[model samples]
Target: MAAEGKINPMHQFTINQIGPKLEIAGYNISFTNSALWMVLALVVIWLFMLGGMKRELVPGRWQMAVEGVTGFIRNMIDTNIGPEGRRYTPYLFSLFTFILISNLLGMLPLAIVPGFHAFTTTSHFSITGLLALMSFAIVLVVGFWRHGFHFFALFLPKGTPAFMVPVIIPIEIISFLVRPFSLLLRLFVAMISGHILMEVFSSFIVNGLGSSSAIGFGVSLLSFVFIVGIGALEILVCALQAYVFALLTSLYLNDAINLH
Candidate 1:
């Protein structure tokens, strides 16, 4: 049995089986919360788009909200990537919506306790890794689509001397491979850290107040107030992280498309 006062927020990262397990080579194939959240993110994006499409001109509250979000992403892409990169708007928009929704949804007290008790997909490295891989794939595809074989020349900066090519080229290649790692780390760390802090503080308040009479109650009250403030900050973080992720993705695409 679990301890009465102990909290286990990290349990959110567990993978619960949904069906008969299948062995693929030597790997265990099973359904998990990570997969569930990925699907939920996609569904949320699809529904938002569909709602916006349904009310193209005579917009309702939902439509207006959807348009405002799309417009913000449009401006972000335009500013960072320019008109030539407008073709990638759908992808950028999708990425932003999916992440934003996932982050916010994780904050909500849902049937499956978002971001807690085997319910958090965003905390899993595999999910973040796949997302980073997708972003890299987009960069590569767009680069090849725009510049063909000439894109390889981007590794060699124009001012580089022949003697320095040996040194700089390998460095550039490593940097290119590390792009996905950076993206994965940024998103994963931000999301996981925020939720973990919130959980820890909340558990503190619950346990602290429950343990004593007056002083504990006062301390718990203070902790609750602090948690509320942190909640607001987390909202900002959720939106900012989503925006930063999409913005950096756009910048990366721009680099690939307009490679030197």
Candidate 2:
């Protein structure tokens, strides 16, 4: 029979200590897959920007490609959030690039297992949650910075009937608080689901061959083909999720500035 005590697919992505460690606040402080991926993502960003910033007149192929990505994010911000939102372009660009690199790196076969079978960092909610929180903080800080106490008026739509104000204000407050929750859950669930589905499908192929006398090799081959297709789909999803996150952030900031 298959192993009775299989690890939870969900738990595979959780943050845990990598070595013996102690914390002053009674929390575990240890190296984790999430930290590793964060470092990897930063390294990828630095290298890409370094190569792209050479500013050659002829424009090397690598520089051109990087410029395309930068231009795309620029246009997205300009078009969706307008000229007033242009100041946020740098943050959006970095957010999208880091996520794109992290997702793509996780899809690589070598990354599926690193340094003696460690869990992939992309599967961890803590990492994804921290990313979501950072975006949330940006929105709050920028909005308040620009508008001061007037930003609080964002939760109270202008010209609402006095009687309806009480009802609508609370609802608005709840929705605002839920933004980070939605952001964290959406990315975490999407990434974890994709990874787990791939694992299950691959495992089935291996198990089928070992258990059956029939032409299980063909089944395994077909499963492998499906895995490749799913991988391509996941890449598209990674980009889409990143875009959705940035788009939502822009929308929130726009609302704070009373643009719409």
Candidate 3:
């Protein structure tokens, strides 16, 4: 139980070790809550994907949903990356589903269950950082592969003043380098901020009941209503963030593929 006199809103984000740590070579890797949640999120995603596999004359709701998502991503890629982007469906689709599930899972009130709670992987910088790096790597590898050494030319745009080449080149290079960091911060901050607000309001409910006063109870009721609204907003944020991440990813791929 939480301490009687104080509530630690940040405590929910803690990563607890679930069992004995194992050493592989010189490094110790302990299974943790964050890792457990990630596995759970993947399982949920896998089950949902299986929903798309039912072959029938009339499609079920699950199959329709799966088809809808598939079409949306396909259209997004075509609009953003053109025909060549078709080759990237597997990566883009997986990215969208993983982040989408991870965000939604974190919004669930499952903390009461032992060894389970919504672990917002996107909120953790480490996870986001790794994703950002992978995105960057994809862009770098594909850019160079397609255009050879000319990929370096992306740093300088056409029609620029010859005299400003040095300044503009470095600036563009810095901006390109910052794409992953930008992606990392946008999703991480949104997830963390929304969850923190939910946590704070939840504590208000506890503190309200403890007071045993009419005004406290009334305020607690108000907090409850507000928290519900926040929860709905967080749900919207989950979908929006996932879409934005995928959209930005498509844009990045366009830049890499066409140097736009």
Candidate 4:
């Protein structure tokens, strides 16, 4: 909760139950605001894709927009993972679109409505961690299924001294294990930091506006200007983070597919 005459930016990220509490034996499976946003994101993606599903002879704006994004991801995979990557396009497309929409949705100015606010699901570690885990799992499955024990060679690199084998192997193993952690942390940190910065400035605006002095008014106006700038930057960050996450996922898939 925010203090009187102050805004609590973190309050926006709070997960509240949307319906009656639900539990299964010893575990609570109640729906939350985070889950609500995830569902909404999926719905938006579906509707967006639906627009381009016509496969018309001549594409309209909707079809063209969808094709453009789809082509971008396809090209990215082709560059990073080559021909074999084509087989993974559907999953990658879904992953990229989902993250992109979810990040953008968090920036929505829905807080104008009483008792309602936009939530950034990706800002949470659990959500990003789950995504990272899913991507890593796919990589593991593809690597082991295709190459068997040869997949272990991913850590060995091309050329290394026999004496350094012990040192290099441990280092490589650790690095390999860090992939999902890095993937999740990167998205989570980028999102949470931007929101926190915006929230801090927002509080300043509120505080300044409540004051009667000229300096306070000036501060409020300045803070609003900064918020606008930060808001634009946040929009860029949202897209960039999605791209980075998708690119990294594709690169990791390449390692599994090509073992390089």
Per-prediction TM-score: 0.87, 0.86, 0.95, 0.98
Q: Look at candidate 3 and tell me the lDDT of residue 115.
A: 50
Q: Candidate 1 overall Cα lDDT vs. reference?
A: 0.80
For all candidates in order, the CA lDDT equals 0.80, 0.77, 0.88, 0.93
Most lDDT-accurate candidate: 4
Instruction: Tell how far residue 174 is off in model 1, in angstroms.
Output: 2.8
Candidate 3: tens digits of C-alpha lDDT, residues 1-260: 26867667777788888899878998879898899889988999889989886966799999999888888999999999999999998888888889999999898888779755667888898988888788889999999999999998889898889999989999999999889999989999999999889888888898898899998899799999999999999999999998998899989999889985
lDDT of 2 at 61: 91
Clashes per candidate, residues 3 or more apart or on different chains: 1, 0, 0, 0
lDDT of 2 by residue, 13-58 (tens): 6566656676868887777666777788899899999999999999
Best by TM-score: 4
Residue 171, model 3: Cα distance from true site in angstroms? 1.3
lDDT comparing candidate 3 with the true structure: 0.88
lDDT of 4 by residue, 35-55 (tens): 999999999999999999899
Candidate 2 minimal-lDDT segment of 10 residues: 111-120
Sorted on TM-score, highest at the top, how do the candidates line up? 4, 3, 1, 2
Between candidates 3 and 4, the one scoring higher on TM-score is 4
TM-score pick, better of 1 and 3:
3
The number of clashing residue pairs in model 4 is 0
